[model samples]
Target chain A: MVEIRMRVNGVSESLDVPPWVSLLDVLREHLGLTGTKRGCDQGACGACTVLVDGERINACLALAVQYTGRDITTIEGVAGGGDPHPLQTAFIRDDGFQCGYCTSGQICSAIGMLAEHGAGSASAVTEHVAATGIALSGAEIRERMSGNLCRCGAYNGIVRAIQDVAESPR
Target chain B: MRPFAYVSAPDVATAVRAIGTEPGAKFIGGGTNLVDLMREGVERPGTVIDITALPLTGVEELPGGGVRIGALVRNAHLAAHRLIRNRYPLLSQAILTGASAQLRNMATAGGNLLQRTRCPYFYDGAAACNKREPGSGCDAMDGFNRNHGVLGVSDSCIATHPSDMCVALAALDAIVEVESVRGVRRVPMAEFHRLPGDTPHLETTLAADELVTAVELPALPVAATSRYRKVRDRASYAFALVSVAAALEVDDGTVTAVRLALGGVAAKPWRAYEAERILLGAPATEESFRRAAAAELAPATGRPQNAFKIELARRTLVETLRQLLTEGSAA
Candidate 1:
């Protein structure tokens, strides 16, 4: 057994778990935060995506013990108390998901993707590597968000939702 | 996944010591591919030595104009690094084109080089895969051989090395620096990944006690003008069906020198040495490109499902060289 200490969704939590338990399990079973869904736990499907220190990664492939001192933000932490985050509202408005098995991961990944773009990161489609704060074209967003898959074929709506937040203040 | 002893090493020495002493111990960085293998019951280690805590995360300039990339450097950071993107554009393009943004953010350079093939037969536990279990026989030899390697195929296995980063490294004359309990030794990228001969299980030449500390790319002006073009079923987040990494130098309307490598067609990054020989000092023309590409792909033995790869590889190489020549003309 390994006792790991980390801030999960803005809450300080210390939990003892098996060394084999993934970060996805720590979020879903250990902390009882079931918002992060697990689909294809081998990291093929991005259904278990979460933010560790503001960067998106597949939680299912990450060991909870390896993330002892980092801050993990799940779908629960996108907005703290009163209102949903801008991207969350944008997803609802644009109908980003159809069946919604991949909604949570999609939202969390979008949050990190926008943050990465704000930090002057380039995507696969970015022709100019040195250019900072790249123009968030649809093709660029699509390529960056390619990890999150929607079996219901909701890519058009998902792109619209991300674009809506890209132009917003939040 | 089987629970094992875990040690998070604080320094490089500690990590190397633990890794060298522990039999069946594996280094965990990013855990993108290794963890997947564990889940598939392909790899069961006695211990996992965590090397992420060690101070091996940076892209720094060498004494020469080349660059030294730390082993723990994430794929995203390496792609975004100014030195890599500016000096080795093909490397940057290759890294960005291989995996998704999230995976790239977590996957390390060392782990990226050691990633296994995406062959379905290898992943299937019930299937007969010589790479997984020696003498089991290859299911992909005649079963669902679409994604199998056409070049460098042995009777034992037909898997392709699924890495875009290494393909670019091969073309740019990069060297892999590895350290063990003994000492550090440098292996060229061309010789780092081994072809799937009789022993397909032995993917890389990395020793059990050794750890890849850094990948060094020598100074090459031609690599600055290099380009990588990948053809696949999807435009993003998929392994290459046929990828080309090309670095060219043209002088007085003639090709002075060239470095070319192909991926998704072989067990290792297939360096087009004969092709480059033909293009060097030749006029930059479609005829010359075709001749060179044909020389490189002549030895390819296609399967029933993947026979299209030969012509596709041919066209892709010609198209890339055409664009390179056009860009040079415009410049």
Candidate 2:
């Protein structure tokens, strides 16, 4: 067993996890933070999406031991204590989910996508690839969110929810 | 996933020593590919050396008009770096057209180059695959070989190298820097990946104890106007059925310089040296482009299922060159 310490959702947590255990299992099974779903347990499906050092990644593929001392933010971390994040509120207000199996991953991925856009990441469809940050258009959101698939086909609502939060005034 | 002992290596030398000592040891970077294969029972390493803490995550400019990219640099950071986007846009575009944003964030530059092929037969243990086994027969030769390969097939295996980033690197004439207990060495990207000759299991020239440190891209002013074209089943999050990375420099309507590479076409990133030969000093026109593309596919032999790839690759090359020729569009 490998012992690892990490800050999850702003809480210090230590555990003796199997070397084979993925970060997804550590978050869901060890910490009881089951918000990160395990649809594929592979990198292909983003159902286990979470933020590692403020960047989005597939939790199912990352080894728990590899994430020692790193800052991890799961769906639970999206809403601090009791208040829901603006993304979460927008997702709820827009009814952005159908079956909701991929809701947590979608929300986390959207949060990462926003941060990436804010940092001036460009998508394939962006006209000017040099622009630090491009306007979050519908195409931009869809292209960026392609990692998280919704078999329920609730992409319209998901896009609307993200767009609403993006255009909202701070 | 199989149970394995994990140790985080502090440096490249320690990592190399650890792997050299343990017969079943393998380096894990980001664990995107290794974990997936391990879960599938394909990769069964008894000791996984975590290399995340290794001091190899910097991207700096070299003295000779080139850039040195650390092996541990995440795909997202490399693609979004200002220098990459402004100078080597082809490299940036090639990486961006690759895996999803999340995968890109976790995937490392070195790991992406060493990623295994997505051949269905290779993934299925029940099927025959020379790559998975030396003497085993190849199932994709006649069984659903649509995505197999059109070049570098030797009846042993017909898998294509499934990396968009490597395709661009091949065109850019990048160099791979690897180190081991023996010594450090630099390998040109063109010779890094081996063809599916008799030994399909030996994919690269990397020694068992060697660890990739960085990749260096030599300055090619022609790469500034280069572009990557990937035609896949979907607009995003899909592997390319046929892709082209082309960079052309024309002087007075005659092609002065060109770099061409093809992915999803061969066992390795098929650098179009033959095509470049035909296009160099030739008039940049439809006929010249077609002739050059045809020359590259002259040695190609395809199965009935994958026969369409030849035409698709032809059209992809033609269209990519046409866009570069006329400055019409970008994919």
Candidate 3:
């Protein structure tokens, strides 16, 4: 077992985990932070999406030992000051999910996507990649959030919820 | 996943030494591909050397107006780097088109180059795949092979290289820099990956002990106008059924310079040298573009399900060149 230290949801935690234990397994099994769901253990489904140092990645693909000393933010961490994140409220208002299995990942992925867009990152659908300040169009949101899949096919509402949060003045 | 001893390398020398000393050891970058394959039982490394801590994550400007991208640079970071987006937009575009945003965030440049094919046979333990176990028959040859390669295929295997980023790198004439205890060697991007030939298991030129240090994109002015077009089952988050990476420079309606590479068609990124030869000094017209694409694809062979890839590749290449032409004229 390897001793791993990481900051999860603003809490510094240390644990001894096997080398092959995935970050998703560590979060769900060890730390009991089960909000980060595991849809496809592979990287195909974004149900295990989490933020490591503010960048979104699939927890299912990351080894727990490889993320030592990094800041990890999961769906459970999105809420701030004892209140649901605005995107979470928007998800509820827009009915952004048919089943709740993918909700946590969608919310976490959206937060990272918003941060990336704010940093002027270009998506596959972006017309001019070199342009500054990417416009958060619906197409751009869909393209950016394509990593996360909704088996219930609630993409319309998910896109709507994300668009609401993106258009709203933070 | 099988249990393995893990060692986080503090530097390049330690990482190389760890892999060089242990025959069962493998280097882990982002663990996006290696971990997945490990879970699938396709990759069983007794020891995993984590090299993410190595100081090889910079995107530096070379002295010759080119760019040297560190091997550990994450795909998302490389795609978003200001120099990459402005100077090598095709590379940026290609990186964005592959996998998904989450995968890209964790996948590194070196890891992307070394990623294995997504062929179902290769992943399925029950299926026979020479790449998985040499001397084993290839199931993809007669199985559901709609996604298999059409060029540079051997009877032993028909798996297509599943990277969009490498296709652009090949077109830009990038050089892969690798190092080991033996010494450092530079391999041109076009020659980095190997053809299936008789040994489908041997994928790249790098030995097991070598670590990819960096990828150098040589100064190529044509890359500025280049574009990558990937035709997949969906518009977003799908591997290419056929893809084209091309840069064209026309001088007074005559093609002066051209670079063409194809994806989802071969064991390696198929650089269309025949098509490039035809396009150079030829009229930059639809007729010439189609002729060149045909000449390059004349030797291509495809199975029943994947036969469409030949025409798809030709059309995609012609269309990409035409789009570049239009963009060039507009500029």
Model 2 over residues A1-170: C-alpha lDDT tens digits?
88999999899999998899989999999999988999987777689999988999999988888899999999989886688999989988898898898999999999999999989888777765566658999999999999998889889999999999999996
Question: Candidate 1 chain A: minimum summed lDDT over ten consecutive residues — where?
Answer: A124-133
RMSD of each: 1.5, 1.4, 1.1
- Please report the candidate that would top lDDT against the real structure: 3
lDDT of 1 by residue, B9-100 (tens): 89878888998788999999999998888888888998999898988898999987999999999999998888887788888888989888
Worst 10 residues of 3 chain A by lDDT: A125-134
- Candidate that would win on DockQ: 3
- Model 1 clashing-pair count: 0
lDDT of 2 by residue, B100-187 (tens): 9999999999999899999988888888888987798998888988887899888788898999999999999999999999989999
Any runs in candidate 1 off by more than 4 Å, and if so which? B328-331
Error of 3 at B301 (Å): 0.4
In model 3, what lDDT does residue B198 have? Answer: 89
lDDT agreement with native, every candidate: 0.89, 0.89, 0.93
What lDDT score is found at residue A141 in candidate 2? 95
> Which candidate, 2 or 3, has the higher DockQ?
3
> For candidate 1, what is the lDDT?
0.89
